[model samples]
Target: MSFDLGLQNTRALVTGGTKGTGAAIVDALANAGAQVIATARSIPADARKGVHFIAADVATSEGCAAVADGVLAAFGGVDIIVHVVGGSSAPGGGFAALNDEIWLRELNLNLMPAVRLDRALLPGMIAQGSGVIVHVTSIQRALPLPEATTAYAAAKAALSTYSKSLSKEVSPKGIRVVRVAPGWIETDAAVALAERLAEQARTDYDGGKKIIMDALGGIPLGRPAKPSEVADLIGFIVSPRAGAITGTEFVIDGGTIPTV
Candidate 1:
């Protein structure tokens, strides 16, 4: 079953749209009839039709500038901006294991792209008096895994705070700013990680998945969420049906945070 999200004829931009949750979001916004411009460092080999692709590494100032220029030149501006380009490559042991460079890298990846892009594109939205921005944060902001993902968690926490502050400043101007925090999504990378854990533990696939869930203090739903699930929620949030919503962080973690 499906419902109209009222995104027809809108222009949208999705960063990191080549894979995983970002790819899912590109598909969702496009399927809902939005003219989607998906930006990544590289284009996908199996890229689909009806979605425009741009190659730019938005972790830097120049990349964000290129994307803003491209979108404005092509479509004047976008009505929806979904910042999905975030991940941690830092070798994790704890806070002590992280150096200044590692912490800065994580912040650049998880927080600054949205900050830069928003700064670049928001004037168009403000002039037009309407837009929606969604930042893809992580559940780790609330449930930090100190041993492995402390840097990632800290970056996402900053992003959440930034999103809220942006929303407050812009909502009165007709721009909606929201952040989506997802937990334990079953993306390809995550599945591969689970598989590696399984091999190390001499366990099967389900057991490997269980190992991850156990590490997260157990997802009450007993499994990870699909990327498409996160995409669908985002679809609704950017639609007219969610017009009144702004400056909120929606958690889609399969009950992983363990609190209200």
Candidate 2:
């Protein structure tokens, strides 16, 4: 029930850390006694205590370079890097509905930022001979909700593959690369969907939640995960306690993904 975790005084960078799952991870890292720098295109109304905010558009190469410079100048290099910047704006209508621009945007949004940041920062980790990189992917990669989020799912699949390949090359150098895929986390966006579903079904909020579960083929344990719950798992992951874990995809889907 109790472990030191050994994360005191370490530094970390979390993309899209202003809200949702990313904010939860930022808070958890700070709670575990690590210096956390959170990056987003704009500043949040209230950046959490013990977390530094850097305004940068992480979807571009320029943004990644600026963040790398800022962190390198501030902390020399971080002990952890958590890539939690991803979303989908692709329209609904299956793969046919998706256009080149939408696909490009989704790829840049969900994958390239992490790739750019890693290229800019992994050298520092390699030099120090240790670091942990956690990519926040989605269960869509495996489940593929094509009609609604085909591009997003495809990009995440690419990200998962990239994370695994990078880990294979870096673990020997003491850099641990891993991915966390969540299914329907209870963030603001998800809440909005539940509200709409409730309206359509003319039922209570819990009814809407069930509708979502059913759409996903039913989550056996019954509900989506809270942001904080997922953060707790991530907190343990980047800590020294999970020193041996790397090149793996940890799914926190409440048993939504039923497979080996």
Candidate 3:
């Protein structure tokens, strides 16, 4: 048997695509023959080839507009958009540690970018009568770490709900919207953090990684996922092969959530 994504010549855009999971998604789609446009606040010197790079923050209204304008001016519209820009800088210490400003920042980073970009870009897709949207959320939405990532978790939860609502509103119009919730992904940054933890704990890198995994209530699969693994799932979700899949959340957590 053979499997094909049928992404040839398809125009796609990925936010936060300069690094980590976003970069992996960019590569996956491009390798599948899609013409990918990727965005970042600053284009790295070693940015990947085979995809157009747009420099935009996407975490602010102005930045989202710039990205939308650039893509529209160039491609008129995109067949697919994978929202991958999100993170938190809020201080850890549970609820009281976060302020209104921090809460807004989390929302802006994790939720609003997807909302703004979808609003700006969806009209073109609606006009075309066909498109796919994948919002990269986090398992933290369901399995939140109160002390460390509460705001991030809340924002992802909002994103998940928004994704479902958007799909219901747009699926009849020929747009497919899906949410992807990833668990810990072993990216380069994660590896570096593990190394730091190892030094602090007087342990090896594996032991350090184990410490973090154990804190997640233990991943039944024995380790966190690879960035490429998440990207591949997104690649398939946006493909014609997944035409009937929409208005749903796919959790790639290596069974870390520990719930049915």
Best by lDDT: 3
Cα deviation at 41, candidate 1, in Å, is 1.0
Q: Report how far residue 190 has shifted in candidate 3, in Å.
A: 0.9
lDDT of each: 0.93, 0.92, 0.94
lDDT of 1 by residue, 109-128 (tens): 89999999999999999999
**lDDT of each residue in 78-127, candidate 3, tens digit only:** 99999999988989799999999999999999999999999999999999
RMSD of 3: 0.8
In Å, residue 106's CA in model 1 sits off its true spot by 0.3
lDDT of 3 at 63: 96
When sorted by TM-score, best at the front, the candidate numbers are: 3, 1, 2
lDDT of 1 at 18: 89
Q: How does candidate 2 fare on TM-score?
A: 0.97
Note the residue pairs that clash in candidate 1: none
Q: Write the per-residue lDDT of candidate 2 for residues 144-191, one digit (tens) a residue.
A: 887769899999999999999999999999999989999989988888
What TM-score would each prediction reach against the true structure? 0.98, 0.97, 0.98
Q: After superposition, how far is residue 75 of candidate 2 from its true place, in Å?
A: 1.3
